[model samples]
Target: MTIDLPEYPFPQPTALEPPAEWAELRAKCPVAEVRLASGDQALVLTRYQDVRQVLSDPRFSRLLNADDAARVTANESGGVFGSEQAERTPVGEGHQRWRRLVGRYFTAKRMAAMQPRIQAMAEQLLDEMVAGGAPADLVSAYGFPLPVWVICDLLGVPDSDRVKFAYWSDHMLSLTRYRQDEINAAQLEFGEYIWAHIDAKRAEPGDDLISDLIVVADAEDGQLSQMELIGTAQGLLVAGHETTANMIGKMTAMLLADRDRWEQLLAEPALVRSAVEEALRFDANPGFGMPRYLTEEIEVSGTKLPPGTTVISSMAAANRDEEAFDNAGDMDLRRTPNPHLAFGAGPHSCIGQALARTELQTALNVLLNRLPGLRLDGSPEELPRREGLIIGGLERLMVRW
Candidate 1:
C-alpha cells in the first residue's frame, strides 16, 4: 500500500509552527522530494534517525552544484549583512582553515567561562525590563538584547555600535526584504568594519576572540587571510546573536502559551535548565532546518536523492519524532535521556550552544523571579511572526507582571 506524503504549506524556512504534518512525513517518507520556492527540486528529511545520520555522516556534503551554490548563497535584496566568499567556497582546504581558525576561539572551555557573564547580562536586561513596568515587549527589552550583548562582549565589539550591528545582522538573516546585492554589500561593509577593528587590535592587542583571531592570522601561514578573518568575525557576530535571540523569544513565548508549564517552571526554579532544553525540543522554529546538498546520488531511507538536490533536515520534526521521544509534543522538564537535536549534530553542531543554554536558563530564572505573576499581555495567536526567515520567532512578545 502506498502511503500519503504530508504537504508543508510554507517554504522550507518560512515560519508556520505546529508542524503536525511532519509526523506523517516522518512515517511515510523518511526522505522525500519537495519543491523549493525557487522552483528547484529539494529533498526533505523528517525522521530523527535519518536526519541525525545525514547531519553526522560526511557522505552528504554542504556544497551543492555551482548553480545551486550560487542560488543558495545569493544575498537577499536590501540586506545590511553581506554574503562572504567563505559561503560561496565549495569543500576545500580553505574551508577547513576557516573552520579551524574560528573553532579555536569558540572552544567549549571559552563558552563555559562566558556563562557567568551571560548570566549577569541576562539579569541586567531583566532588571531593565522590570524597571520598564508591566505590559512590556520581552522580545524588544530582554530576549533580543541578552544575546546581542553577550555576543558583543565576547567579540569585543563596542557597545556604541550595537544598534547598527543589530540592524545589519537582522537584514543579513532576513529573507523578506533583502536581495543578493544588498546582502553582499552589507557583508563587504561589515567585513571592512571588522578588519579595521582587527587592525587596531594588532597594534594594541585586546583580550578577546577578534584579537585572538588576529594573532592566529598574523602568525599562521595560510591559516586565514585578512578578509577571511573579517568574514569569520562577521559570521560569528551574526550567528552568535541572531539564533540565540530568536530561541529566547520563541522559548519564552512557548512557555507563556502553556500556563501550567509556565507555573510549573516558576514554582520549581531548579527545573529551569531542563525546562529550557524541553522548550528547545518542543517549540523549535518549525520552518528552520539545516540545509545540505547531495554531492553524488545517494539513497536515503529508501528514497533516491539525485546529486545536487538540496536536502533540508527538519530539526523541529526530528526533535518531535514520536519514535524517539514519549509524548514528543508535550513539554516535560523532567524528561531524562532527552537527546534533542536542537543544537544539531556532527562537525557543524552549534559552537555557542553552551553559552546559549546559560543565557536561556539565566533569562528564564530572572524573569520568573522578578515577575512571579508574569503573564501574556496579549493573545499569543494575535502576536505577529516574522516571515520569510529561516529562524522562527515572534516580532514582539508583550508581557505583564
Candidate 2:
C-alpha cells in the first residue's frame, strides 16, 4: 500500500515551529513514502526512535544518497531509479585517521579556549548593532556576520575577504534561491578563490586552521592535496556558516516569541544555558535531517524497505515526537535529557558541534544580557522566511530595544 507523505519541509507559516503535518504523520503514519518536488519517491521516518535508529545505523549510507536517488527512470537499463555515482568514502583506519586529524581542531577544550574570542566577536557585533540604533535587521547585521567572522578567524581568512566567502557559501548551501547553473558557477568561483588563498597561505603559514592544514599537507603529500584543501575550505565555509548562524536567528526568534520566556531568561541569567538547549531543541535547524541511503534491506516500524532505498529523516519532527519527551511541543528551559537530534547522530553527526554550541550560547547570552529590553518588532509569522527546502531560518529578524 502506498501512503502519500507531505513533501519534505512542508510550507512552514513561520520558522519557529515545524509544519503541523509532521505531527499527523508521526501519529498515523510514522513511516511513509514521500513524493519530492524533484518527482522522486522516498521514505520519511518521523518518529523519534525510528529517526534515531536510521541515523545511528551504519548500514544507512550517506554516500549513496548524495544525489537525488529517488527519481525513477523509465529505461530498464538504468534500473528502477536514476542515481548519480556515489561519492567516495574513506574506509577503516583511513577514516579514523582522517577524523582524528581534523576532529582535534573542534574539541571542547579548543572551543573553551576560543570562548574569549567568540565572546569578543559577539560583543563587537552587538556593539555595532547598538550603534546602528533601533529597528535593525539583526539577521544580516549580526546573525550572519558573527559566524562568518568566527569561521574565517579559524581559517585565517582576512575580514576583507568575508563578503566573497559569504557569497560562495550562501550559494553552496542555498536550496531555493540559486538555480543549479548559478550554484555550479558559485562553486567554481569558490574553488578558485580557496585554491589561490591556500597557495598564498602555503608560502607563509600562520597560527590558524588553514595554516595547520597546510603544514599537514606538506608532510603527508597525497593525504591532503590541493583539491582536498579546496574542498575542506568549502565545507568549512558553507557548513560552518549557515546552520549555526541560522540557529542563532531561529533560536532568538523562538525565545522572544513569548515575552514571558524572554523576561524569565532575563530574570534568571543562570538559565542562559538551559535557554540555549531549549532553543536548539525548539528551533532545530534542518526541517529534515540530511538524507541517507539504505545499503541493506531494513524494516522501520514494520515498513519493510529494500536495499538502495532513499530515506529522509526529519530531526525537527523527531525532536517534537510526543513519545520523546514531556510537552515535546513546548520548549522547556530545564528539560533534562533533552536528547534532540539537532546535531544529528552517529559517525556522520556534525563535526563542528562543539564550536556551534559555543557560538549559539555566547550569541544568545550576549543578546539577553545586554539587550534586556530587546523584543520582536513584528510577528514572527509575518517575518520573511528563508526560501529553501534543506534549511529553514528567518530571512530577516527585525528587533528593537
Candidate 3:
C-alpha cells in the first residue's frame, strides 16, 4: 500500500528530534511516497540501509536529478549546492575531479595541522563573548563569527565581505522561505561577489584555497574553468560557514538541553569529539533531504521504483533508525560503530567534513571550559526555529554563564 506523503519542508517539529511521521514510515513503509513543495512527487527513504543504498548507488545520479524539468524553477535550478545550475561544475567525474583537487588542500592532515590555528580562533571569539557578559545570542557572538572568520581566512576573502556573504547565504539557502525573485536577486549579487573575488585572486594570489585554485587554473591542462573556479569558491564560501556555524549553535543547544551532558563533557575533554559526533547524529535540523534523480528502475524493502523517480533520502530518519541503532531516540555519547550519516556518504559526501569536525570539536572544548555556567536561556519549546527553509536550525540560541 502506497502512502500519500505529506508536503515536504515538513513543518518544523516543536522539538529537535526527527519527526514522528518518519519513524512510522520507516516501520510500515520505508520507501514511502512524498509530495514536494513544487507539487512534484518523490520517494522519502527513511530506513537506514535504504537511505545509505540510495546515496551510495551510482544509478541515482545528481546530474540527472538536476536535468529534470520538474525540479527546475524560477527559485531554484534544482542545484545540489543550493545555487544556480550553471554556477556549478558537473558531477560524476567532475565530482571526482573536485574531490581530488580539493583533497590536496582540504586533507585530514591539513585540517589536523591547522588545529592550533582553529583552537586559537575559537579562544579569541569566546574571549569576546565572555567580555560581552551573560545572556548572549550564541549564534551571533560565537557560532556565526567563528566559521565566517575561519572560512574567509581560508579562502582569502576580504574582511569587508564576510557580512555580505552571510546575508547572501541566509537568503540563498532558504529554498522555500524566499520567493523566486528574492532568491534570484541574491544569486545575482552572490555571483558578482565570487567573480570579483576570483579576479582579485588572479591578480595577486595568496596562500589560500582560492589562490591555490588560481595556480591550478594557470597550469597547462588544468580542467578548472573560470566559472567552475568561481562556483567552487562560492560553494566553499556559502557552505563553508553556513553549515558549520549552524552546527555550532545547534550543538551547544543540544548539550544545554541536559546539564549532565555538559558535566560529562567538562569532566573529560576527550569526550568532546564523541559529543560532537553524537550532536551531528542527533540534530535533524536540515529538514529537507538532498534530492537525487533516478536513472534506472530500483527497489528497496519490496517496493519498486521506476526510472526518472525523485527520491529524498532521509538522513534524519535513517540516523535514528531502531534497527541500526539501540536506544535510537537517545543521544548516546559512548556509542561505538556509530555509522551516522551526519556528514553523509558516498561520492557526494561533504568534502570539508574534516575541517567541520575540527571546528566543532574546538568550539565544544572552548565553550565548556570558558563558560562554566553556560546553559540555555529558555526551554526548547520556547525557542524558535527556522521555517520554510531547506536547513533545520535555531533562529537564535540565547545562552548565559
Best by TM-score: 3
Give me candidate 1's TM-score against the actual structure: 0.87
Ranking by lDDT: 3, 2, 1
When sorted by TM-score, best at the front, the candidate numbers are 3, 2, 1
| Each prediction's whole-model lDDT (CA) | 0.68, 0.71, 0.74
- What's the TM-score of every candidate structure? 0.87, 0.90, 0.92
In terms of lDDT, which candidate is stronger, 2 or 3? 3
Give the C-alpha lDDT of model 1. 0.68
Please tell me which model should have the higher TM-score, number 1 or number 3: 3
Query: In candidate 1, which residue pairs get closer than 3 Å at backbone N, Cα or C atoms, i.e. clash?
Result: 75-179, 75-180, 76-178, 76-179, 77-178, 77-179, 82-183, 82-186, 82-187
- Candidate 3 local distance difference test against the native: 0.74
* lDDT (10s digit) by residue, model 3, range 1-401: 55566877556457566677877888898877778776677778888899888878866665434323112311110111222222246466776776678767777898889889888988998888889887889998888888888888888997567789877876766657777778778878998988888888889989999999888777888677676787778777777777787788888988888888888887887888888888887775655665668888887888888888878777777888989989988988877767887666677667777888888898888887888779998886667786765556677998878
> Please, what are the lDDT tens digits per residue for candidate 2 over residues 1-401?
76565665577656665777788899999877787665577788889999889878876665433333211110000000001110123434544455666778989899999989999999999999999998998898888899889988998888677788667755655556677788778768877888888999999988889899888777845566555556566566666766666778887888878888888888888888778777777763353455678878988898888988988777777778889878998888878778877777765566677888888889988898789999899986677777753556678999999
Error of 3 at 227 (Å): 1.5
The worst-scoring run of ten residues by lDDT in candidate 1 lies at: 76-85
Candidate 2's displacement at residue 42, Å, is: 1.4
Error in Å for residue 391 of model 2: 1.5
